[model samples]
Target: MSSEATIRRGVRNSRYAAIPNHVFEDSRLSMEARWLLSYLLSKPDNWTVVIGDIIKKGNCGRDKARGMIAELVKFGYAEREQQRADGKFGSSVLVIFDEPRDSHAAEIVGETSGVAFLPQTDLPATVSPSPVPPSPVKSAHSNNLDSANTDCQKEREGARAGSEESDTSVVEDRKRIERDFKAWYRTWPTSLNDSEQAARDAWAALTPEERAACIERTPTFISAVKAIKGKFTFSSVYLKGKAWEKLDDPKSEVALPTVHNPFSRAWMAGMLAILLRPPLTANMPAPTKFQLGQIAQGGDEADAVRIDRLQKYGWPRVNTMHQRAFDRQGVTVPPPLVAISEGFEQVHRDADLAKRWKRAFERRGWPWLPNTGHEWFFFPAGEPDEALAKFSEATARERGDDDAA
Candidate 1:
């Protein structure tokens, strides 16, 4: 029987996927991976699945689904590209079956006619300036207001201090809109090319009214994608397609996944780097990654600064390396830096362990003290379990002697 015929027997509806058979047979591919591939394969060509769609449909968390898809791509079983989505760049994820059986070819679907999608162009060289508002005449009456009403009068000052505040508001509003758009943009299932700069330019082109509308419907887009149901409107797609017009439609709310934060994400990466295993030394508790952000925090920096602010409130600041060193109760090894310190390559020598390891080295016909430039054994910066073992054996013998006495 053909692959399509067998798949149809298992699935009642055409919408439901029929996974490929070889995927299960390949012992290296995990079941989760197989399912993800099947899901992508079942879709029409150029069909995009956002991160939220994977989370919802795959019954997994946002990060897990993202990581799984990344592994799928990394393992060379999938290909992802950014192509035109209604004239703006959008992700196209496809299953890669290098040796796909002839029967499996019919399962995949889509029209490859390039006529509908045009390559996304950068921002136009010039933007038409917003219509200048007619100057408002400040009434002499505002000048007569008492101290209590002074703020009101100052706010109404035409084309002076008040105008400055209005301009500030416009700039700040654009910033807020861009920040929100980035939050949604980064959650895409695949990465983009020149995403940050491109997003900024597209965002600037949006009218104030359209920007507001897009912000309003962002939550709806988020919720719909998480349901694995509607088409996702990414920031680039929104800019090109004028998707803000669709915000008027009612949408059902689905509980949102933990939103992505570039800063907290860095922190979580540092946190997940906490490895405890044989290759690790007590001195080297897994290194954490926390690069200090820019000093001036504004615009897109809002989310990172907010997270750092919260982190400061919860966890007291300290010299992390020093704290780790003190906790380990072990001396530091010469860190391999590019400066003069890089020459400090003398390995740590635990005196007691070294004495015990010396005998073992000799017993094993390994060099303990050799000629100059020979591979003389020093305490390993990595796992030194053998040293510990010999020390334990010596102590055991001493205890035995005491018991006989």
Candidate 2:
């Protein structure tokens, strides 16, 4: 058994900010991006946090923070705008989660922030904070002291520092809200996908928990709807109704799986059912162009191996077939056994039927490719006939091994 390990950490006031669990659980973000997101959420309202401050406080280099910020903005988790150093109207504001529509500034006064940020492991506590508000009662008491001017001077200096910290916090917060807005804009699924403005309003109306829940369930809901519709797009669900709100409890559980039956396919007489692709009824197109990516493991090297397998085994068998008879007449009918196998497959979707037919055909040294969606042409194989015969023998032996077990 491993020993329990204790870790030491530094205390910071930013820990006061609450971070929701959903942000961390999001599969769309990287660890660094998520941590930066939490840090921005921890700042006081209306503060401007500069990149330099993030670099310094985040304990990360300039390039890393920049890249993380770029990634966040790209995915709609953060936003940024240029600001002029000369005091102007363009100064950034960390306007909580959403842009206020009807709520007056006076109304929101003293209201706690809807978003709270707490630091994660490998992240620094980010709440440098706004300058502390002056205590009116203390100022009144200090007025009686003879050294009031000195006290006032010290307070002024402290306020300036606080103002700077507050500005940094605000800047970071604005970036965070911008990300939230962008994320909503890009990801909100609807039935009739119009009215960006209405979407924004609906998004703002949702509580943080509701928004998080919607994001979590978006994929599952989209998939379930698509399986039922036969032709579903994000727009199919998104372009018509406010399906996002209904995502809190998904009604259907069905999901269309990968539309292929690659296993239980075999060779018969010298014929093999090398490909057993199923029809795609979902919004995605039937595969028009065949590539290794279609049947690949999706890594660069693995894809290369799949391509090699195709080139080595697949293309050669296709190339050497005798097409002379079909070219001369346009129809070279399969021998009697091949015709019967083709007829049987026309009405059945059974894998066992395909495999048994394939094995029986292979025993006679012919492999069978089905005619579910493509034209089947007959041709003579010189060398592959023997190759396919051996292939069938190996398959038969393997099946025997299974049966014996």
Candidate 3:
């Protein structure tokens, strides 16, 4: 047989109420009655006990509250005396004691004690009450009780202050968690739809260190999922499983698939033309013709570098560039560049590429080589009609296509 042991602790300078152990030890009293008795005893001697107060404190219905009080009264832990005012019967006032009183002794003591009872004027007409007057004399024991009550009050005040601080900390931490969750969610390739709330809750449950790990490892996970052609799971399930924890660091992952760019110079120029559209570029300073060419060339080179990195080191390598862009300039990787690096199939459907390029050039006020019949274009709002003549002839001579030109 297993033996059980009991342990007891005594309070030192800490705030606490003193109660007779017999109250708890008594088998005759109900647990509710014992608790109610302890609560009453913890109050100051002159404190009034009301049924409403008891109901609120115990979170119980009126019937249960009254029943507990009746139990205490039956056990001789409390007494009630009906009042008389102007020859009319009034509501009874109650007195609770830390120890039970004998019925015969209670009667004699009530007659001689002259205990004061406060009236409840604001209460229902059933109990018109008034305040109790303070006693003119204080004994040494009364002074000691006052000191203990003072300590209890101080302890309560300190506890309340600490609780407020703790609540503030919790609020601040939740705000930070929500902000980080939004950042992480933005990087997810697919929509979560209905699972968003559950995902947020799961993310909130993670420790700060775990959250950081999850955020840092997400790109690698995305790469793996894409590599295997696996379907993405709900964000809630991902977070709950701590899926990022199982993946190796992005730097060590290998066998990345090669990504290829499919945009020709003409197609790229058209895309760049859309990027530099008036409505979008209105906030940007107008670039010179030379500067526009440089911008297009530079943009193309950057896209090529990103594609190369994606093929060599996978998504994490390219995602690091996105992170750096945001961290350094508070911006995201440009959409066109992202589209080009993720898939070449999108660029393969190029049958309408030249038509779209023509439309873009027309909208942006650029014109094609006049004699060459709109084969090549010049940029930056307005250019001479023969702007590409010299370059086209030089290209024709190089290809031995002078007669074709």
Candidate 4:
């Protein structure tokens, strides 16, 4: 027999996909990717592909399944768009295209003729408005003139009532907007309130509901700015950009301490706690003057803001510069300490150890610096060897430093 494999033909089943020859013949896609595309194409229009279903069918691990999906996406077979629900960020919606989308294609899934994979949600069903009924036909010569006069009078009265209500509503809305604007403007940092007129314009442009959202979300946004120690955007700029949409519900921010006065002892203490903290990345040397100058020259403001947030909020607030800093030092940076069920108990026990370590650390003329997460204690050099060794071993184990090693 020849080296080429013998071909066999089978009857085409209704379930089989009628895929184009190019899907398999294309050099850009791997055999696995081709199979995945074919499998997806075989599904009925608008059929959602669950990752779990794909994993089960493919007999592959989650990563391998996801990798195949990603490969399809990379080759323009699918697109994912982030979605928002009830004013908070939600899971993405995937849209699969028969052909690759162009750069100028609409981002909205509904706009294109593509199969959408939407997550099933337990939200209440939406009630659509009822359609208007057709106007009743007029009967001739049956007290028509009297009916016409009565209808005209009713119309005039309704018009007068509606006009008065509309005028009153407009006045009230304007007053509320002005009152709310003043208060919101005051909440903004004094240094960044330069564009009052622009802010007013932006505010006026929003619907009543949007205005309420901006007002409600501004406090959390302010706290985030304060936490990062970043420069504030102009009120107008912030309003226009609608940056508040990205924030979580203010209820989740209860952990943040309320600052009644910035100069108060408690406020100062918290700020000191933040400022005196150890650097986010170990072995990241400080930038030299020349390097600093270069950093300042291009995109410094944005970079500084990003780095500050990362330092304040831990590594979940990612920063490439910090990653590179750790990489250069040959260090595997650990994720921020997020206390789980048993870890919470460990954190409480470590509290006493932390206090003892702090006392010893201070006696050695070293500053007591907490990590960003405030989950671990500081380790200053030149303390008693026994205390040092005990604290080192305990902290190393707690921080997963030993495991990493």
lDDT of each: 0.38, 0.38, 0.46, 0.45
Model 2 TM-score (2 dp): 0.21
Model 1 ranges off by over 4 Å: 1-18, 82-405
Candidate 1 lDDT score relative to the true structure: 0.38
Better of 1 and 3 by lDDT: 3
Q: How close is candidate 4 to the true structure, as a TM-score?
A: 0.26
Task: Compose the digit string of candidate 4's lDDT tens values, residues 1-405.
Answer: 111111111112222466645555545667887787777776543333345445546778667877877876787767765545588654444555544564433233223433332333645234332242111222211111112112221222222223666445545656776898888888877525377777776676455567789889888778755543457778778887787774532222212323222222222222222323344554345665765766677785545543543354432212322233233322211111111111221222156665665565444333334333334322322233463554344344223221111
lDDT of 3: 0.46
Model 1 TM: 0.21
Q: Where does candidate 4 have its weakest 10-residue lDDT segment?
A: 1-10
lDDT (Cα, 0-100) at 117 in candidate 2: 33
**Residue pairs of candidate 4 with colliding backbone atoms:** none
lDDT of each residue in 22-141, candidate 3, tens digit only? 666555678888888878676544444335446556878768887887886787777765545679654454666655676654454344444312233444223222254222222211
Write one digit per residue (lDDT tens) for candidate 1, span 178-291.
586687566543326436655555654454565666667666656545444455544566565665444332222222222212112211112111111012123333222332
Order the candidate numbers by lDDT, best to worst: 3, 4, 2, 1
How high is each candidate's TM-score? 0.21, 0.21, 0.25, 0.26
Error of 2 at 131 (Å): 16
